[model samples]
Target: MPVIDQLRDSLGWDVVLTDDADRDARSHDTWPVATVWAKLGRHPHRPDAVVRASSVEDVVTTLRIAAQTGTPVTAWGLGSSVTGQPLPVAGGIVLDLAGLVSEPVLDEIDRTVTVAAGVRGSDLESWLGERGLTLNHSPQSLGRSTVGGWIATRATGQFSSRYGGIEDLVVGYQVVLADGTVADLGQRPRAAMGPDLKQLFLGSEGTLGVVTRVTCKVFAHPEHRVVEAFTLPDVEAGLTAMRQISQCGLRPFLVRFYDRDEAAHAVPHEEISAPVLFLGHEGLTSVATAEHAAATAIVASLGGTSMGAAPVDAWLSRRYDFSTVENLLAEPGGYAETVEVANVWSRLAPMYAELKQTLAPLATEVLGHFSHVYDQGSSLYMILLGRADDDETALARLEEIWARAMKVVVAHDGEISHHHGGGLARQPWVRESLGTGYPVLQKLKDGLDPAGLLNPGKLGFGRR
Candidate 1:
């Protein structure tokens, strides 16, 4: 029997799919290059089959068969990854884990929730909100992305300044290794035990194993909320204000500072002639008020003109709108992409300036904004849009742009990726970015996935 037939025999016929539509849909994720390929009706890496595993046993059986047959099995969430992490490059089996949904179990006393990997972020948040709770993790792709995808990519949310990224929110997970072994790790709040093994799969991009379920921290919905916006004379001043606020231990829950160009695009007002900064605070009424006041004082001291709550409110209203990038990518001969990188505060200003200057000639527009602030530094998103004469030229230009951006990032001693895990888009620089850590990753891959079948050729792992 063929592999698909065998999967059906073991896991049910409905669970196995070999249709062209299913294979095509799993070929590429939301990666810009992949988007371009999609626009041109091309799916270069479609899997030979798709297995919609609805239960852990289904996953175990599929992996066991794949391992026995020397087949590649790449896990799929909602295909929201922008880095091509879910592309079935090796063309064996695409395990569709989205069907593995489980009713979330909330631990009111522990302040955490155990949810299946297929749970959509927005759905989970809505479910928690009904009970006066929240996951407090809202990535831009929250509506479409899954909790498993979040864990796999090491995702961060907009409210990360106060609540932290997915890594901080995740308390434990249940995963299935490459050879059909199911491992449940990190069941406690904290442990002095061996290296938190759950971390190995946190950002592994499904190269190490498949994340089936997650137990993550949850917060009661904020009792009060405050939004503050400021006009900074320059990006440098805005960065300084953010650092001071963070270092002062005032958690705003949301901190976004846009460069001049991005500010104009974001605010879209002739009066918006300077960089814009937006801060938000939430908690008990009194606590939110106090933090808002303190953050306002810091911004004022830095010569930040108070723009009041209007701008921030405007942003909050449409925070999840991704049509700008989507529409641009859909257009013929058009290209758009966003790259996020981070470093220490001292190097951020120079790095930002150098990146903008270096990328000026390559694209029609290069805009940036800073968010996910920490005491040490923050992530900067470089948004670029350009056009070419044709699809082939556009794809080539995208590669060139990434190559140039990575060089500038390395020169500035900055991380190549902050939240967007190294899908194929960043594969070329993963080794350089990981440095000595690269070989350690290789060892881990070898030890766990000795057959080199799980998500082959991603994150500088297995085959390239």
Candidate 2:
């Protein structure tokens, strides 16, 4: 029998979609490059067929068929990616995993929750809310993203400074390898097991395997919460205060410090011309209240000007808004993109200054914010805006902006990406970023998926 015939017989054709409409719908994700390509009457690779995976068995079946057919398989979640991670550049079968969900089981004793990877972020949060527990993993894409996508991309929540990112939340997961083998990685909270295997798949972006289920740590609802706002004279001052706060052992769940231009975008109706900072804490009443006071003192000692919680509340009320990017793309002669990079404290400031200054000429406006901080340093997110008359000019300007920014970051010894993973957007730089490690990563990829059927072309893996 033909391979296509075997697939048609193994998984009922009802679960398979090969028509033009389904292929078109599965073509692109939220990758800004997709938007540009669409406007140009072109598109990235679209899968030849889409398999609606309703269960782990379905995924296993698909992989078995892929192994025999040498068909590229790119797992699809809610498709909320901005990094073009889900683009099916391999032109084979796209496994849609958004519909496979099971009820979340809360292990109250262990303070962990086990859930199917298909669960949406908002849905999981609501289920936990009924049980008086919270995941504390609230990324801006919460409503549109899935647990598997979060784990696959190694995503970070907005309150990552305290609650931690997906990597920190994930205890273990069930992955289906390229050969249809099921691997259950990790067991105990902390294991001295040889060669921790879970970390390899955390940010693998489906290039390693398909995550079917995930078990992650959870937290009790905070008994006390406080949100405070301040304005620094400039970003340099704000950066200093943040470093101090992180180093001083004060835990602020959210530490969002935006430059002047970004502040204007954060609150359009108000006048926020200077760099702004928002600090928020939520935990035990005793711990939170005392820490809030201590944090205030520390900020005051650093000459921070208190602006009350009004600004903080305003930002909290609309933290997940993506209107800026949406509206900009909708308008003609308008272009904008956001790039995030990270480095040690010693190199962060210099890299930030270099990239910001270097891209200023090409961009009409450049805005930045430092969030998801660590004791050593922090992640810097740069949002840039530019304009050109046509798609050709616009694309050239956009590519130039990314190139200039990436060169500066690489020169400063910063990782090209912090959490978004090395998808198509960062594939070009993965080799340079990894240095000697690229060969090791390639060896790992070859050993796992020799056919190169899983998310091929991403992360500098096999070309699609």
Candidate 3:
């Protein structure tokens, strides 16, 4: 019997899907290229079967069956991945984690919560809101992304300047390896005995193991919240203002600066505007007020005009859905693509100028937006758009633009990726980024999964 058939017979029939339509539907992730590729009958790639696993036993059974038959296994979350990280290349079982949703257990004493992998961020946030707690990790895909998917991709949210990424929030994790062995890491608050294994799976992108559950540190809901928007004369002034705020130790929960073009595209102010900066503050009522005052003083010193609460509130309300390409493509003769890069504070200004100069000639329209703030520096998410005769031509143009921009980023000592995981598209550059450490990771993969049966052709792994 085939692997899918045997698994269906072993587990319930409802848990396994082998229908052509079903397999095709679950194959690709939310890659923007899929919007064009699907119409051309060239879907990204599809797995042999889709397995909806409900419990840890279900995962163990699926992994064991795949291991016994030497079949590849790829885990799927809510299918919100933009990097094609969940694509099943070897035609085996696509283990959907959506069925593992379970009510979270809150340990108030420890200020942490243990949640099932399939839990959606919006769902968890609402559940925690009733109990006066919050995860403080709200990525742009919060409405659709699952907890496991976020951790698997090592996602950073808008509030990362204050709460940090999923890596920082993770206290412990339950993961099932390719060999059907379960490994639990860091149940205690802190450990100093050995290397941190939990960090390994936090951003493995399903190459290492399947995360079934996660224990994450949570914070009490802030008593007060304040948002401020400022219009700056130029991008450099905005960057300088943000750097000064960080240096002064204000630590605003959210701080983002958009270039003039991006500001026009997003906010579109007629009365008074140049580049724009959005800052959010949240904490105890008194503390939040103090931070807001500090931020106001800093913006004023940098020659920025404070637009007050209305624009900031509107921007916050619609921030998550604004950048989605689907929404942009809906407009007449409109299409959009985004690329992100990270650099140290000292290099960011020059890098930004160089990136703009490099892509401006090639792209019909280009804009840069600063998001995902950190203590050290910030990330730049660049948007590009153009007119094309067809989808393929449009994608080719975008790739050319990305290539030129990446060259400038590398020259400026910046990372090629900040929040987005390196999927098949970015695999070519993985060796360049990891250098000698790349081979060490490959050896680790060989030792754990010699057959290369776990999500082949990803993160620069498997036989060429």
Candidate 4:
């Protein structure tokens, strides 16, 4: 019998799936053509077998088996990723991280917590809330995406403008390597070591190892929060307002800009004559009040029209419900897709315009929104919808749209991906993004995963 067959007998039929139907279902993450029409040009590859690992031992055993058989290994989280990062191209074992749901341990004295890889963001937040603490990370996919996957992808949450991304929150990690070696990065409050090795697996996307547990910094639950919304004359005006607010040094937890179409899609036939910007502040009562005052003053100075708090509250309520994308995709003659691009403060306006102009013709409807603000600039999330004969055609159209948009971004000097890692979808642009140092990245991949057993064909380094 094959190794997988023997392993199936040892691990039980319920844990190991070899059926074609089961394999097909487990092989691919949710990469329907409608969801990627504005991002890539091809259908995602599905893995050969998906091993639903229930414990660290299972993960170690699975990796050991793959190493012995020269099979590739990829980790799967919640399948919420737009990039084909979790897709299995080499037809090997997928170490599904969903099965490892261990509860987090909060150390009130240290003001820190240890979380399992499988804990979803929203669940973790609620769990911590019961103990007078909270995980501030609130990505759009918070309800479904796992902590391990978030750290693996270096996800930026809605509050990244204030709280920072997963990279900032992560302090330590427990990882399982390709050869089944367990490595524990220090769990101390601070380390004076030569290098922070935890960062290696933080954004590794399973190329280096599997993250089983994580220790992240947490904050006390805010005593007060204020939400505000405004309308700017145009995308450029919105950008200006955002830049002014950032320069003012009042960091709002949520700062979002929706272009004309995105504003319409998000707010519906509301009489907004301009782009919409939403701001949220959270902290102690006094801090929240001060932040709100500062934010409102900046918006007023920039000719923004205040729309009260309803819109901001609505966004907060439904921030994690991306299931709507799937519903939109299921519509007849309807499709849904999103592409995110980041550029310098100066290039944001032009990049936004160029992206809209490039994708407008190909899409029946094109909407753009900006979030994940930084000191330098912000990232644009472009949502596109259209009609297509099949997933392949839709994906092809997306590839064309991204090609044009990427060209404009590169010409104007911007990074290809901000929060989203380069799965197989963005491999073509990796060289351009890395420039002269691209070879160094390949060398690192070669050194760490000599057998190329980890997430092969993704991140633009490994052999296909």
Q: Which is the leading candidate under lDDT?
A: 1
Worst 10 residues of 2 by lDDT: 1-10
For residues 1-464, could you state the per-residue lDDT of candidate 1 as single tens digits?
Answer: 37877898898878888889989999979999999998889988889999998888988999999988888999999998998999988899999988889899999999999989999989899999999998999898999899999989999999899989888899999999999899998847778888888788989999999999999999987889999788998888899999999999999998999998899877865467899998999999999999999998989998899877888888888989999888888888889889999988999989999999988887899999999999999999999988878878889888888999899998898999999988988988999988998899999999999989999989997652
Q: What is the TM-score of each candidate against the true structure?
A: 0.98, 0.97, 0.94, 0.93
Local accuracy of candidate 2 as per-residue lDDT tens digits, 352-395: 98988998987789998889989999999998887778777777
**Poorest lDDT segment (10 consecutive residues) of candidate 4:** 34-43
How many clashing residue pairs, candidate 3?
0
Q: Is 1 or 4 the stronger prediction by lDDT?
A: 1
Best model per TM-score:
1
Q: Per-residue CA lDDT of candidate 3, range 335-370, in tens?
A: 566788888789999998988888877557788988
The list of candidate 3 runs beyond 4 A from truth reads 269-273, 322-324, 330-334
TM-score of 3: 0.94
Cα displacement (angstroms), candidate 3, residue 132, comes to 2.1
User: Which residue pairs show backbone clashes in model 4?
Assistant: 37-398
- Model 2 clash pairs are none
Which pairs in model 1 have colliding backbones?
none
RMSD, each candidate, Å?
A: 1.3, 1.5, 2.1, 2.8
Worst 10 residues of 1 by lDDT: 264-273
Candidates 1 and 2: which is better by TM-score? 1
- Misplaced by over 4 Å in model 2 are none
